[model samples]
Target: MAEIQAKDSGGKGGKPKAKKHSTKIDMTPMVDLGFLLLTFFVMTTTLAKPQTMEINMPVKAKDQEEQSQLKASNALTILMGENNKVFWYAGLPDAPAAPGVQVTDYSANGIRKVLLARRSNKDLMVLIKPMEKGTYKNMVDILDEMNITGIGKYAIIDVDPRDEELVKKVQ
Candidate 1:
């Protein structure tokens, strides 16, 4: 039988040594690449402003009977139809009437004028009731008008019964 033999040095009893391996990773290149990516993202991305419209949302009610009564004097209701037409009704709920109503087109200037005139009291609240087909852009424009007119205290009303279900389907 052939037998394996180890190499000896110094004519004595020394065996050949195995080559040493390095386990440490060279991190300089990796760190440089990470910094480059971070800088690129920082330079390319635009930072958005922190300003947002402060709007009060209505509480969820199980039934119309349990719905809380909102004061007519404090609340101003703006209605948006499916055709993108806007109408506004102010005063008591039972006696609600659309005054100086403009339809068929969205007018920020008119809305601004009306809101500014109506905002006699800083404590008054404005409520927006957007229909199902109402575009979000219209809502945002209305909010922008409100903001420009210094009407900050407002609420968004989801009067549509199918709103929650539609949102669920979308998600």
Candidate 2:
């Protein structure tokens, strides 16, 4: 509620005139109502839960050499390093004069497009080799890309000395 007060002041004709009082608004109820609505919304609304990508890792085997083999053409090797550097190539690193690594970024038009293009080949596999110089975030981002591309045949492998040498040459 709002009210006004008046003070008598002398006018030009010596007659007393009403002086307007400054406005004073009591916002106690308004503030209370605002908090009440806020509490109600907070209590009644459902918060979105954090989502996670499902990662399928290979189980440890006593005889690692017994694992099934993948064709060379079916493999794409990713080498991640600091400063947002990504070097990718086809076939194994030990292949005779293995394919030259192509430099790319993690953007939607970069690695994402590359992976999507390779999606056409169901038999194709992705091997992620994160170098010692690579950041943890780089690994996570590449993993996210794998899940986004719906790639079921991907593995996080250690950096081979030969692959490390290739990264140095490309970077």
Candidate 3:
């Protein structure tokens, strides 16, 4: 609703006064229309879908002996520690000729280099061991690296006691 009113200035010295008009605008329709547009946009707009990484786990073997046989040369172990520390070894840490555990970060030149070096091995399997002090971010970072490097076979296993000792020694 809108209205206009005229106000008369009082006559002074026997002179006629002029009238001034003032307009008032009602914004109720505008306010209601604004709310309707907001509601329409909110109801019709689509929200982003959550992004998730897909991991394919191996099927269990009936025989324990068959399941226990993992090639040492084809295995790579990555250990996540506190403060975003990363340590990796070419093969099993406790193998007969145990490989030395080397420390690396989560940068393109660090773990990525190591992963790329062995990417040619078709049977390469990466084993991720998150230590007690490691954060969830560390785990996610390594998993992302696995995806980035196109590593098909990988597992998130618990850190062994000997692996923990090795990590401590390197730290």
How do all models score by TM-score? 0.49, 0.73, 0.79
Give the poorly placed runs of model 1, Cα more than 4 Å off.
1-69, 96-105, 160-171
For candidate 3, the clash count comes to 0
Worst 10 residues of 3 by lDDT: 61-70
RMSD (Cα, Å) for all candidates, in order, is 12.5, 5.5, 3.2
Q: Which digits, one per residue and each the tens of the lDDT, describe model 1 over residues 27-103?
A: 78888999999999999999998987666666677777975666767767676666556666564334445233334
Position 88, candidate 1: lDDT: 66
Candidate 2 regions with alpha-carbon error over 4 angstroms: 1-42
lDDT measured at residue 1 in model 1 versus the true structure, 0 to 100: 25
Q: Which candidate tops TM-score?
A: 3
Cα deviation of 51, candidate 1, in Å: 7.3
Where model 3 places Cα greater than 4 Å from the true spot, the runs are 6-22, 56-68
Cα deviation at 19, candidate 2, in Å, is 29
Model 2 lDDT, residue 63, Cα: 86
How much lDDT does each candidate structure score?
0.65, 0.87, 0.90
Q: Model 3, 17: alpha-carbon shift in Å?
A: 4.8
Q: Best lDDT goes to which candidate? A: 3
Task: Give the Cα error of residue 98 in candidate 1, in Å.
Answer: 9.0
